[model samples]
Target: MSTTSNPYRGFRYPAEIINQAVWLYHYFSLSLREVELILAARGIVVSYETIREWSLRFGRTYANSLKRRRPRPGDKWFLDEVFVRIRGKLHYLWRAVDQQGNVLDVLVQSRRNKTAAKRFFRKLLKGLYYVPRVIVTDKLGSYRAAKREILPGIEHRQSRYLNNRCEVSHQPTRRRECHMRRFKSVRQAQQFLATHTRIHNHFQLRRHRLTASEHRAARDHAFVAWRDATGTALIG
Candidate 1:
């Protein structure tokens, strides 16, 4: 097992509170002040600014630790891109997920042209260090042009309906964008979304496909894994 050392050095609050604060912010489409309100309701008084600091500090660490424990991604990858507003300008958020709905990677770029598509494709493949058997994407000409240059050997399927898995995956990000009133900058959107995807993936159990007992067991397992990943036991 790959162990992650605690990154919460010299922190006044316990690791549990810190982890929970980060979790509530990333795992849900809640704002910093909203998280503060929620924690206050539970009798744990903490400022929203502090919560933001904790998120910026420990969010990436926790996400990286969780990624280390994730299973190898499925062979069929679904790729998609959506426009996000940053500082009143448009940027493209490129994302990929496997057949099992496991997020492979995300990238924010200024354009959605052939060059942008190629860059995002390379980044996703390089980060994973593995090639997919097939890639499903919308009928974006840039995708075809980019795929030919990047991984021509891989099968590419183009159909808007066939790529529903990736389309559905963007809903959470859309919700988060609304909650934050749109991202302030491209870098900020990339950082927050990257961390958010990992944490969301960790807890997304597809409960609809599970029996009640199985759902409970799966949820408990996810929490245990989260505790291990954050190196903090959540206390009631």
Candidate 2:
């Protein structure tokens, strides 16, 4: 396991408390105030604003740590984009997931045109390193146009229901949107969703495929990974 330098150097609280507060915020669909309430219930007197700062400060850093520890993405990639409302303006959230539902990358953009598609493709390529054996997407003309320009050789499959895996992946974002009363800005949506996806992917072990004992073991393993990723175990 690779070690991450501690990022909690000057924080007044211990690493465990700071990591727990951030975990509660992103690991679940709870608002900052809601997280504050839960911590208050536990006799911890952290304010909502402080929790917000901690999430903003540590969320993406921790998410990147977790992503680094993840296995290589599947050879077959599923790509999709969904519309999100940011302060009443429409924006696109482009996401890619592997066959087993591991999130590869996410981008928020103002358009879903060919240019937007190409931009997302570039981001995915720069991050994932390896080229996919095949790409699956819905019947979006922009996808075909982008693929033709950027990844001409890879197989591109498109159908109405062919990319159900990517479609189903949007459910968690929808739930989070409703909980937060919609995102305040595009950057906020992008940042939160990026962190949210990684945290979700870590614990979403597809329980139906596992026995009860296996599921419990998987959850425990994920918790240990979370601790390592968040620097809680390392510091405390």
Candidate 3:
């Protein structure tokens, strides 16, 4: 059996329930208790704590599976950073996304200096098969400094208006942070957001840009991909 088939081997609850619970929590701004209540309304009596455990254990696994299945990221990369307050300590969330709005990666760090920027660049390029043709960012000197050392040959565009795509991408993270009453720690924030972005972006069809039938087709394709990632066999 494939390794994907083994993740829920010892779990008592069915894989469907676990998959649905994790999906509801991460794909939406729902809390663990909210997910518990949603499942309870469907006659499943799982506790919020159990749901939390499920998320921590299996969320990254599912996300990785989906990432492996996604198409190659766009060559035009847009990078941005936003401050996140965890327990009154300010940290920066460095995020990279493609021109198509696909999240490339995210890193949470204590600083936004050149060192932090270089670290984020390295993380972003770690698994990428090809380097980006152009990197766009706001007028941040760190990006300029880091790009010189890390991505020396790539084009770097610095403009506030041109980077709105990356800036807008941060809105979802902000919403999720508020919904969770802010993350408890740096590690927690990093782990959760890493999984959250992948899963969230997977299902985020550009409906406005797609026709209704095209939208439905994209959504159905997304569901099929989700089932494959979760190792949930289709029901006849």
How would you encode candidate 1's per-residue C-alpha lDDT over 125-176 as one tens digit per residue? 7778899999999999999999999998999999989999998999999999
Q: After superposition, which runs of candidate 2 have C-alpha atoms over 4 Å from their true positions?
A: 1-5
**Candidate 2: residue 99 Cα off by (Å):** 0.4
List the candidates' TM-scores in order.
Answer: 0.95, 0.96, 0.97
Off by over 4 Å in 1: 1-5, 233-236
Best by lDDT: 3
lDDT of 2 by residue, 110-147 (tens): 99999999999999999989889999999999999999
**How far is 139's C-alpha from truth in model 1 (Å)?**
0.7
Among all windows of ten consecutive residues in candidate 2, which has the lowest summed lDDT?
Answer: 1-10
Candidate 1 weakest ten by summed lDDT = 1-10
Tens-digit lDDT string for candidate 3 (42-161): 999999999999999989988988999999999999999999999999999999999999999999999999999999999988967678999999999999999999999999999989
- lDDT of each structure? 0.90, 0.90, 0.92
Q: Which portions of model 3 show Cα errors greater than 4 Å?
A: 1-5, 234-236
Better lDDT candidate (2, 3): 3
Global CA lDDT computed for model 3: 0.92
